[model samples]
Target: MAKVEQEAEVRYANADGLADALRGADALFVWDFLSTAVPDAWHAADRLRWLHIASAGVDPVLFPELRSSDVVLTNSRGVFDTPIAEYVLGVILAFAKDLMRSYDLQREKRWQHRETERLGGKRALVVGTGPIGRAIATTLRAAGMEVSGAGRSYRANDAHFGTVYPTDELSEHVGSADYVIAIAPLTEQTSGMFDRHVFRAMKNGARFINVGRGELAVTGDLIEALDTGQLGGAALDVFDNEPLPADSPLWTMPHVLVSPHMSGDVVGWRDSLVEIFVDNFTRWAAGEPLRNVVDKDLGYVPTGTSRV
Candidate 1:
């Protein structure tokens, strides 16, 4: 705080306190990336030049006005990549070993033994080829899983994922994967991507894991798929309605694991997120190009754009 204040005047504002924080502000650091108050407060950002979000996903802060403006938008891209990849791997292992069911049995004081699935040699399809997805592919491969990728285009011999398929052709190849993981950025083309069709296309008893934005999957379709056994189980860290209404059936689903959007949040995660902003802030003050500059049109930070 002292260092930032020494650099320039700092105006603090939460979601509701932004009435005047953006007025004449040259830069803004959005720590509350999920807050929609920015759009309502956008009118006050007259002299704003740079806006940085403290999260990998910039969708929350990338409002239409900001997108059309001259302001440079940046995100804390690399901060959560490894953490999220690790979280996805944890979910995969939990599913393969049926750890959740074991925990339930333990709570009921029942002694039961069940055959568990093996992780090694199992096929995994990772959607999205960004840093997080790439990290997941690498980690899964290290765990002896056969990992592939689905992204915007097809690529051969990717360093992490050997065969990267086009996301548009997901249904055609989704059935082959024993585990399907979604970690893509939220975009018009990706919203509701995991609908009934995609779920139905998966091989029976295959697991699904989503650490991406909630809107990526159709909640109803996912529930139906789980109910009808289209998917063996699901580990959802995000949801269409956060706090996941108490009445939602997903809560009690035997095969579903509902997490509160904390997949990338490991211990001391806040400090890591803050470091990105502070480093970028130092660059901003020195007139150097900022890292994690997002391509608003594409809704993410494009590859090879993060400068040293």
Candidate 2:
């Protein structure tokens, strides 16, 4: 508020009063990235010109009305890239060193020792060639792992990504990877892309990690893969359903690690989000092009574009 204090008036609204609040509002800052209220309240947005979401993926706000409207939609993309990349590396190291087992043994007062897998020479098949995915691949490579990326199209020997295979080639690489990571956006083509066929194609004992949208993979198929030993384990940060229903078997699975969709969040993340919004808000108010403006039709910021 301090940055735009002189130019704009800020109004607060929760889900219950959102529709009414949207009336005559020229700009909206959706602090609750997960809220579905924006779409429902969109009808009341008589003066809305710009809508800013404080998150990377804009799936939650890509309702048909907003998609067809002139309202400028923006997201906080670059802020979470490095933090999420670091999270992926931390989890990969934890799995390789069997840190979970060490903690379990400590709790039982058993001083047992075991051999761990070497990260070097391991292969990682990273889906999604966006900034976040690229960051993950770079970090994994720095840690001595061989990484290959898959995206909407194939590129040969790009500067950041040596070779990015098209999505069609993903199945071919699944069976050869020690780690299969999904970080793609939630889109028509990507929804449920990881199913029985893809899971069955994975190398036996190979681990799976999803820092992307949950709907990208079929939960039931993943469970079956782990149950049948087709997959060694899974580290899931997102799920088909948020909060992952208490009775979901994944919570108790010995080989599975479940987190509440927080891979990209680090200390002071909320403040960072606010900062991004404030900067964009300043631009919006001045009738200048905004940062992180999403390609509404594509559902994300276009590649090779400046984010901030």
Candidate 3:
């Protein structure tokens, strides 16, 4: 499309520019990671035959018109899992060994030889069984943590589903674990799941890692938890709002680390998204079985079992 007369239309400045081009496009590639609220999404949606989101999560883009369409929908499932998993493990170790504290003390020229703990032997309960959650579980398990994962469908007695449980009883596993990782998808059930009660239930000094949606953890509740020593610390990559609003109290908290959600950023990120699209596009155009096709009825459910 870039080589043709549509070359000028193909150039993009951002979501606005890309959205402008979508008006005439038969298929739309929703690569914008920000939560877009384009009221006129249905304008192009009418002509669209397919919509592919570059980000793993799609709840932000699932509009009424788009959702009701017969257009095949997909997401970038396996692209950022490894990078995010690596960051989760790094934060886990950093919290366990008081690396951040050591750095702070060293900055003031203070000599402290504190016997810190290791990530090994700590129990971790990943709240979601999504690709990112599974990736975190596998990486944490490799680091010697007793990792367990649960989603909406996991069963306790099912021996074949080892180290995995159902999402129904998150409070049961979450309260006792040394680490509580929330990679759960944002749904009606998960929006404010990590409220005051949830935070109060977590073991004291237990670190909370959230690479998932920001709303998964209530902002005020998290602040109270950190201030009251209910949680040791937090490493937040995502937020309820982007750039996290410069004046947000989370930025000033000593026990919390605020990041700009750069966990999935890689040198080849754009090329990687394009590569995955090209592979799937070829199959899609050929009328063959498409890969990464989302389960729309269940609202962007990622099975992680690849069609390829």
- The candidate with the higher lDDT, 1 or 2, is 1
Top lDDT hit = 1
Arrange candidates, best TM-score first. 1, 2, 3
Where is model 2 poorest over a 10-residue stretch in terms of lDDT?
A: 158-167
Candidate 3 structure quality by residue, lDDT tens digits, 1-308:
33222332343435565556667676666666564733355565446777777888777876676677798888888888888899999888888888898999999999989998877899887887777887888888888998777678655642222556666666666777888888887776788788888788889888888898898889989989999999988999999888899889899897787789888777897888877777776666677877788777665545745632
- Per-residue alpha-carbon lDDT of candidate 2 for residues 6-54, written as tens digits (9 for 90 to 100): 7887788999899888899998999888888998888899999889998
**Location of the lowest summed lDDT over 10 successive residues in candidate 1:** 299-308
Q: How well does candidate 1 score on lDDT at residue 158?
A: 90
Clashes within 3 Å, all models in order: 0, 0, 0
Clash pairs detected, candidate 1: none
Error of 1 at 230 (Å): 0.5
For residues 260-302, what per-residue lDDT tens digits would candidate 1 score against the true structure? 9999999998988888888888889999989989999999989
Report lDDT (Cα) of residue 40, candidate 1.
92
Off by over 4 Å in 1: none
